[model samples]
Target chain A: MNSHDPVSDCPHIAQFGEAALVLDAPGAMDLGAQQRIWALDAALKEQPGIVETGLGMANLLVSFDPDLWQAEALADWLHDAWVRLPPLAIEGRVWEFPVIYGGERGPDLPFVATHAGVTLEEAARMHAARDYIIFAPSVTPGFGYLYGVDPALVLPRKKVPVMVPEPGTVSIGGVQATIGMTPGPSGWYTLGYTTRFRHPFDPHAEPPLQVAVGDRIRFVIEKVLPC
Target chain B: MDNLALSMGNALLGNPDHAAGIEVQTFPMRLTTTQPHLVAVTGAASAFLDGTPLPPCWVMRLEPGQDLVLKRPTTGARSYITVAGGIDVPLVLGSRASDLRNGLGGHEGRDLRDGDLLPVGPAPHSTGAQDFGAQPPDETLAFTSASDFLDIRVVPGPEHGVFTAAAQAAFWQDDWLVSTMADRMGMRLSGEKLTLAQPTELRSGGILPGVVQVPPSGDPLIQLRDANSAGGYPRLGVVIQADMWRAGQARPGTRIRFHRVTTAQAIAARNEQRDLVAALRRDVARYAELPGFTR
Candidate 1:
């Protein structure tokens, strides 16, 4: 049972809209706080009137029926639940992906390396060093936001996002790393691409997603294509 | 999708409110039916069948080989076209709605190209009825604004109080212009730069459609259908669900003004909308016994 103090003068809880409430822990982005949020999400799913729940990087959004619960009362209930609940340590599986760094698959790999004041080889080495924790599910299905990016590779997202045509594109954003599950616009710096897990999301599949939050992900450098 | 408009379109054809319909956003869409069917067009567009002009929010019986054309809307962005039995695309995840980005559900999970055949569900027996019209919900349940700007009702978000007094005042007072970046995902608004009292980079959190998030750029963005499930930008406010249809109709260059309302008021507005839909359902039920009436 690990009890941690929330960031000073933070943990803003209020109505997200007419039917939803959001509890945002405006503190340091860490695993301990996210674990508590996951615990709260699990506990609230069983409660009556709560229609749905979602996880963000370090925040929780709960959708409820307004007729069943008042906005103020629900907000209060969320505060109480968060304080009283214990952190959940999910026993999840670890997945390793073989990745090819640089070349057309990851057009921004050289830029990312240069920005970090490190060579392309060093950047790839730093990125694959740690087993990042799947922080939360992304906007799309299958892939989730991965925590534990090397500090040297930490950089702000591009001012303008470019369209990444390929899925399974390994990219890095501010203090976090993720894999592109679908072709869409992205502001993150693309570092590499992985073919081992090309399509991670399948609607026809029972679970649809093979990985879940609390799972660990490690990337192995399969090959490096010259820029 | 504009739920109210889609529901109304289905109701006009005597179909259930959740029946699958074609959501048309681009202009001058032309289609030819292989069979006779009762068709209804709801939301912003002028519809015509073989050059015979049809009224707005109106439904008509179309004979096979009769071509239908939907011209660009003058007032709104998207229009919904529903048949009697509804578009029978294979349901994915309990919905026929297309996820164009992910390429799942709805017509091969992609845009409907020319000459593509659509499978429509079985319609009811013909009742000899030719045409029926429904009063557009926009006219009956109108959000009145004295100015040219569209008045969208909103509720304060979680981080609403974190903004400076001036920024908060500007948010309510300023008339924001919808930028060209508007799309199904969200709309970027251009107006007074809203800044927080103390700049903070919030950790990503779950966000829903209609949540107004203010990024570092100071311009506020209104999330809409197909919005991301999560975001990191600080939230300013969220447009009420009842008025989301109106917001969805706003095209680029449309002026918008945010009207603040209490949570209770927002819920009350939602109830009003629900009641309106109920009234529409009852009205459509009267024509259900007709041979041409769909389920």
Candidate 2:
């Protein structure tokens, strides 16, 4: 890891607030940038006086106690960490989920198929064919944004969001795919429902999230229920 | 704010055992202690020991079986009760603060219900009644009433330039109303419909409290403490950390206006606020040492 060069992967760091700073990885979302972000998230955790660190799709937010560390020093520390960032070797598990495609389970499946210029069955096959890596948890507890969606199946988000999509609804928006853990408003195009995905947070449970950053996921189509 | 008062109580009582007991929703809850303890009430609420109205931000000693009733604040929305030797709830994620969203922390990861018995940390060897009670300086207390207009300071966000000129102008010029959908997670602000200069799709990224995101609907949402760790919404600006407390105290109908500030200015404001808090802590420590002072 130490043999790796730092200048090529150094991110553009900026101030978020009086006590927090953000390290933004350049370019669109990809595994490389995500790995760099995870590496930096790990590096920041080892620093002294850091209150908390939050990982984003392609960015990392590092918060520190202002009394203990100055803003400039914190920024410098992030730069130093990035320069010495270790090789991306994140340990995670691969979990398989059973999904029901089309019909009432995913009202937007037909819409997504038509938008992507494919038949309903073909859309489901394309979605289930590829393996996805969990980029990071997003929007809700236990909800993860997955990478590796087939570009041919990518679709734009709804102009108006569905106010209460059912929980465990697997959906795609832009180039990313996600699973809804709770019923809430969303703009993603729902393509299926997964029963195997679990709510990632439980207060009494150790390590609240079922999936962490860098985990792998694969969806298997169980059945297509009628709308 | 509760943490600040709890530290003050610990200092005045000469004991490190102190935890903040907060009463949210339907104030004026009564609590009876089994033993004598030093307590202080801060934030947007009033405290009464037995029948005597206790002063806000001042530490008061409670006798055994003495009833303490916390009444709602006339000026603010939340009240904090700091007991010497902090509330003894088993720490979750290394914090005693209740996490309502994840249902962790505090008493069983939930709100303090009626008849709930909270444990307090053991008092240190020097635990004794102080000669003088310490009250926070008036200038140190920042309270906002629902009737008052709020001018919150903000710094431009990463996507601030993507919004149209007119939309940006309206954001700073118009008075936004806090919608009924306000909570610890975030608050929806309704006002001039804000639109972007061009349609853009952003990836989910790290988000912080005070981030003002403008969705396609044009209504701005101010993320709060319990907001999602990351989001894809286009951010217009972020409320300065120093002024976030004001946003937290705002009620549903409160009118809000954004004031743009430079990064340097935001840092300066935060430093100033920290200075005041430090001064208050020092004042409490000094007052507690005065000879022959009593309530």
Candidate 3:
């Protein structure tokens, strides 16, 4: 969601463990915060000895190898980087991800539309109108949890949800729209389906991933790409 | 491939970081060596060398042609082997640990088997804790055939407020048993169903290693080493990093207890683990000037 004010606020960086740090803010999803977190994350990836980075709503966890750098050194490095970023602007990418909504493909779409007081067609139209930012990967590997749910269709997700959804299924759980990469149960709204997502485990693939944390995404209506 | 330790079912080993090693799930593994090496075995079973009882969780020196057999532990489900100077496996992606979910990063993307001449990495400088005069009783853990059981401690999660008060109370009062389906990804536990307060739609949340989350199924899944990058379920607690090493040893049917602590306590516990690792690394550093490292 690329709005100036997110539901949450700027997060202060804190230690997650002896070798990990949590850069957390209490604010809801905001485009500015997400972009800021991504820029720092991108920079850290090039730096040596980072174990892995775990990005979340209002926080970006930087886990590193402590055998090489002391905990204090890592903390200082993160603090300095978070404070001294050379202004990185969010470069919006226009991507038309194909989707087939409704039916078994998206059983939850009609219900979601009805719950939000929007016509089924209007729900699809409004969803496609704005250029959405792919914020972060959800619980499932290829699931892209997105921001900017059209106010007309913003509603809570199912209290009890399906445990497993097929891979490449586009889903919206809450205001966030995400794409499932693997077959597992999920409570996200089944908005549509797509084939653009990569599998969760591909060893030889470089970047071995289809999307990044701050990439921009849009939905291309089905009938264009046949399954 | 004479006799390989086989898995009647799936075998679990809790190596330090779950390094690349031989998984002797089915008994009668025949390890023929070219040189004498020091090693230790730990987990849910028992082990023997040349028909002599071998130690579990502690290191031992092995001679060439010495036969090492890992008999199942009585009380635990998995065991580990930490060779002196450490095992000589090449670290992929900065970890000697296996990426079990993906299976691309350890011992050529497969577990140990017959005829595999495993490479043992050079030794870390150290005080030889392996020479523990005597190792922690490996047999102590192997008390029963279904020997996988442990009670774990938990610190309330970063998003503990997301769940209702009664849910949190139930979390503390209930007994959670680890599922046999557990692995590197996580230990799925069956216990009192957790209820959410807001049930508000949330972003894919930030998750820490060992953070416990209750999904819509109401079962609490404790995230482990190979957990997803992010999640949205209501988290109940996080297993302190130091204690995490103990958790990897947990077996199915193990009963667990959750104890909430402040962030300060968690931080202190984390540092305590770092200190332990640091001590081990310092011992390894003593070999920095040896022939292998002397350029």
Candidate 4:
């Protein structure tokens, strides 16, 4: 199924709070699906008095100033935006991320492969071969939820997640891939790492991050270098 | 003036954008303004100026070169102050609000401390006056202890049938107690095992905020604002937006029951609340105390 559509016939429909409406985009993780959701998300920003728009893997929660407009008006505006969201172009360029597999660097590699019924080499090859697209970094500031794990490489998350997974830790779990934003523990496979992210908050220079949702990531194995 | 404490207090007042003032949590907050300023108090707390109890959530004028002090609250968890015009902090992302969890926006992404002087911005548009409800609306319905969530409403998920009808019925009828595991990430509720009819590892799909997802444990996990963007468990339903505040105020021991609602009913309830907000009438001075206005 596409990103916005879920196999679930009755996805929960509810309000996030007093002034926000949450539409569940269950089962929507693919690039094309994310693009559709993103388009609607971007358009929702145009609604007057909207405080901010938070995009998630499966749903878009829109919150506005309750004191300003009637909730019905806001809901109507959103439902219209939903109908108008344009189809996303899937030809987005793919990025190759250099990673250092297994051993000390990737603490979860052996466990991940073992869970996936594969060897370290097979896991690495499978991980690097497929193109995983980033959905959103809202999970933990810079922590990105990259999708498209080779179906064979997927596994359930760890029973307990590490509080601090260390900065730049690359890992995969089940059908999701993650790159640590700051040092924070995780339940995913810790593969390798990179610092190609261009995040700047110099009010004068530009914005905080250069990457957007449609970008793709491809892993390239590289030897670890020291400071 | 305790510039640091004042700004930090303002940042946490109900999502940051609300026209509320800070209740100088800890004191010795001394401010000598060069010009007049406007202010107000919000949330459910009170404030004071110069060691004297100040009217909370109303506008007052600050005189030029005036030294004003904001006293701390004796009760209520958080007290807010509103300047007629909101503080002009740089808006990061799309909000002037601070996200302490991720440490983004507001001042330096940390709590405001001493000597942090603030520049005031133009006041938000005044909604003029209408009707005084005699009292502010109360969200006291928010979950406090564990037993309060007895009537939690949950609907069936697309995979609703994936669970035995009895399991689904049990999910709706049984009383679920708030588990010790609760946070901005999610709240794990303790109830009868919501066993699925069959064990299947669904592909990692999108999970929404407030959606009830059931894992192998049979207990339901209620997602929150800071929840992961996606998950792998079977979801039951989404919580109504109006009830999110209740979830936020949920401390522990909130008993919950699942109730299914039609799309029309959910939409109507949302509209009803909007009508109330629109119908609210309070002066700019009603919420913020603007200091030093001569006209």
Order the candidate numbers by DockQ, best to worst.
1, 2, 3, 4
- Give per-residue CA lDDT, model 4, range A139-165, as digits (tens): 554536678898887777777777644
lDDT (10s digit) by residue, model 1, range B51-75:
9888888888788888889998777
Best by DockQ, which number?
1
lDDT sort, best first: 1, 2, 3, 4
User: What clash count does candidate 1 reach?
Assistant: 2
> Once model 2 is optimally superposed onto the true structure by TM-score, how far is the C-alpha of residue B136 displaced, in angstroms?
5.2
Residue pairs clashing in model 1 are B127-B291, B127-B292
Model 4 Cα shift for residue B174 (angstroms): 7.5
Interface RMSD of every predicted model, in angstroms: 1.0, 2.0, 3.6, 5.9
Which CAPRI level is candidate 4? incorrect
Per-residue lDDT tens digits of candidate 1, residues A41-152? 8999889999888898878899999889987898888877777888788878989999999998878889888888988888899899999998888888866888888888
Question: Which ten contiguous residues of candidate 1 chain A have the minimum total lDDT?
Answer: A1-10
Model 4 bad stretches (over 4 Å): A1-87, A114-119, A135-138, A141-143, A195-207, A224-227, B1-37, B46-76, B123-134, B139-239, B246-272, B282-295
lDDT of each: 0.84, 0.75, 0.61, 0.57
**Preferred candidate (lDDT higher): 1 or 3:** 1
lDDT of 1 at B186: 93
Model 2: per-residue Cα lDDT over B1-83, one tens digit each: 22344444455555443344664545778888788777666655477878788766667777777888877767655566667
| Fnat of every candidate, listed in order | 0.88, 0.51, 0.44, 0.15
